[model samples]
Target chain A: SAVISQKPSRDICQRGTSLTIQCQVDSQVTMMFWYRQQPGQSLTLIATANQGSEATYESGFVIDKFPISRPNLTFSTLTVSNMSPEDSSIYLCSVAGQGVGTQYFGPGTRLLVL
Target chain B: AQRVTQPEKLLSVFKGAPVELKCNYSYSGSPELFWYVQYSRQRLQLLLRHISRESIKGFTADLNKGETSFHLKKPFAQEEDSAMYYCALRGTGGYSTLTFGKGTMLLVSP
Candidate 1:
């Protein structure tokens, strides 16, 4: 098990503004991921953030809209650019445990775009 | 493409009653399934995984390859069990991303 935390637990941003959510892990991990959860809905993978490399984004999500940076094994950030009402969702960071499929998630950053 | 389907959006059960949250997946190769829970105002946490075959907090999930399903079950529900539950599937090999199902909201009433 791993402990993870996120910054700006909750925020309200005006439309067209941008916000970057930070994710920190207690231990060094090779694979980190970003996810989005719409209001009363399921989780959607945004991208895979690996240290010192370009992030692999999922379908329907582009780097221009949701850019990710994994500078090191223990830290990553996801920035929601040009935010809109539809982009308002709970953003989460997760790290995969070594040699297993289990993933540990961080406390989500809830963003409300007005 | 790998996908997970959780048929029920909401499940309401009485305290001490049996509870089951259905989850099915679509994958070509061997599937690794997991159950994640998010209590109100808390972050999502892994509850159990099929590969581990271990029960956590009185909750267990059995993977049925024939049915391509991994359903979560609890013999006696507790009031604190009320939370949003998500079924996730991992792609084959290390570093594969996870695909999550539309979560099921379990409401265990007192």
Candidate 2:
């Protein structure tokens, strides 16, 4: 399993503002996933960030609203643009294990949109 | 559509008592099952996976493909085992993204 360091563990943002969350892995990884866990809601996949290319967004999620960046194999970022109150949620980054699809998640970034 | 269902939103039990958390899934193909735990203020971590067939902290889950279920069970519940448990399934979808259930909160009392 790989270790992920996520910054801005918790944040308070205003409506229409954007927040960029960063995830840095200790070692190179092939795939990095982004998920959003809203209050009292199940975790939902936002996108898959592939190294050196644009992210592949999930259904109902677009790159314009939830843009992603994977500059290298060890780092990725997700930006929530034009945020609204409904965007308040815990955003997490995960890395898949080698030889298996088991993923290890980071201590999520809790965002409160006001 | 792929989905994972955990019937119980909350489960309570006393120490030394047996415990079982039910989970069911709906997918067209065979899916890998997993249990994830989140302790107070901690990150969501994997507890066990059906493929591994291994027990961690005395917890195990058997995948019953015939029933389309994977229920986590432990012989004797401990206070430290209290946490939010989520049942997830990895289907044949692209990238095998995990589809998680709305977790169940377990409380083990003395």
Q: On residues A1-114, what C-alpha lDDT tens digit does candidate 2 reach at each position?
A: 799989889899999999999999999998999999999999999998889778888899999999998999999999999999999999999988753558889999999999
**Model 1: CA > 4 A from native:** none
Best by DockQ: 2
Candidate 2, position A101, lDDT = 53
lDDT of 1 by residue, B1-110 (tens): 99999999999999999999999999999898999899998878888889889999999999999999999999999999999999999875457578899999999999
Chain B TM-score by candidate, in order shown: 0.97, 0.96
Model 2: residues with Cα > 4 Å off, grouped in runs: none
User: What is the overall TM-score of model 1 with all chains considered together?
Assistant: 0.94
Docking quality level of the chain pair in candidate 1: medium
